[model samples]
Target: MTKTFVIDGKTIPFEDGQTIMQAASAAGVYITHLCHNPQFTPHGSCKLCTVNVNGRNCSACTFPASEGQNVTNISKELNEDREKITQMLFVEGNHFCPSCEKTGNCQLQAVAYHLNMTDNHFPHFFENREVDASHPDVMIDHNRCIFCTLCVRASEQVDGKNVFAISGRGIDKRLVVNSPSGLLKDSALDVSDCAAHICPTGAILIKRTGYSVPIGQRIYDHAHIDAVALASEGEAHDH
Candidate 1:
């Protein structure tokens, strides 16, 4: 018999080595998260997947799923907290969705819409960050990054290129290029690199491809994020 755990009243089975996220995704359950790319190792930095597991708050992305454990995934308080977290992410960055090319295709935006984030609850940081258009086919707009490290892990794991890394401490945290000149043009990144397109936001983008599909006909334009996230990742795990 398969070992199982209860998440939001639904029983989800899991193998020994699978994390709570892996099991949930395989079972068609969506746990809101930004830092989790099943293609790469789980990085629980976002804390968006925080669930009430047996009266304790733990990151579902890193927390292992065990037998008979009760997990509270979707609740009133959980959804409210997720909305606040999404709002904080917006205020921390310079996200102008109307002007952004990744407006409709962005995961962050989709998550915000999914959680019903109607307005910016907090004050904007408005931090002046870098927009490196030095690379001919790629660009880095630091203002939109939420520090999810998707690009950083994608480069190292998939492309086998250590082209990106997150540097600095808390509050001062920022993405850093691997080149000596500290620019995308100087780095060993190409248009085909996994890191070039793995950003969950508009932080990293391919040049000249902006608005290719138009705003209204984009990824998140029609579908909700719960459906989108289900179809996006997590296929090669212990399914």
Candidate 2:
């Protein structure tokens, strides 16, 4: 039987046992979320896509959608909170988009522009982290990570290699590769590995194509994230 849930002031039909995020995506309702990759199990870690479920803040990516459930996706308050979260992410990491490789197509960057964030308000932590280039094919740049956990989830769930694991707790937490030796190449990941394909940033890049796309033609080259967001909004309207 098909069930219906109200999303963004409209009734959306979805089946039982489907997540709100999944239903929204299928219904073309774009919810701002990270760490809830369709390719991997929903972790709901980033909490970027939190929505109002029956008037309470809840993570939409993992929340179950049911008949008659009232889901509020877009709102001034929720949008503000999401912007604050994105701002935290911006200040927490060294996401200097001009210098970073994943400038435009980066989901975090896209969402930031969607939120109209011009500058990071908070002070930077500037934690000294090093990029591990031991892997011949890919590099692990923890400095650029927002602790989204997509990489970890991708490695463990999608790739079935269980190479990446989170260590420490709270702000100290960082990704660590599992193996007798502490190296990504030493782990089950190879150059053409599936785990590397799901990374959203330059953190896990294919060595061969590192510089293949000229700077001008790269994904984020011509557009600031706002243009992409506008284009996406236009596409949604057209559809």
lDDT of each: 0.91, 0.76
Stretches > 4 Å off in candidate 2: 215-239
Q: Which stretches of candidate 1 lie over 4 Å from their true place?
A: 234-239
Q: What is the TM-score of each candidate against the true structure?
A: 0.97, 0.88
Best by lDDT: 1
Q: Mind giving the per-residue lDDT tens digits that candidate 2 earns over 125-185?
A: 8888778888887888777777777777877776778888889998888878887778776
Whole-structure CA lDDT of model 2: 0.76
The 10 consecutive residues of candidate 1 with the worst lDDT sum are 230-239
- Candidate 2 colliding pairs: none
- Report the lDDT tens digits of candidate 1 across residue range 1-239: 99999999999989999899999999999999989988889999988899999999999999999998899999999989898989999999999999898999999999998888899899999999989999999999999999999999999999999999999988999999999999999999999988998899999989999968987899899999888778765455544
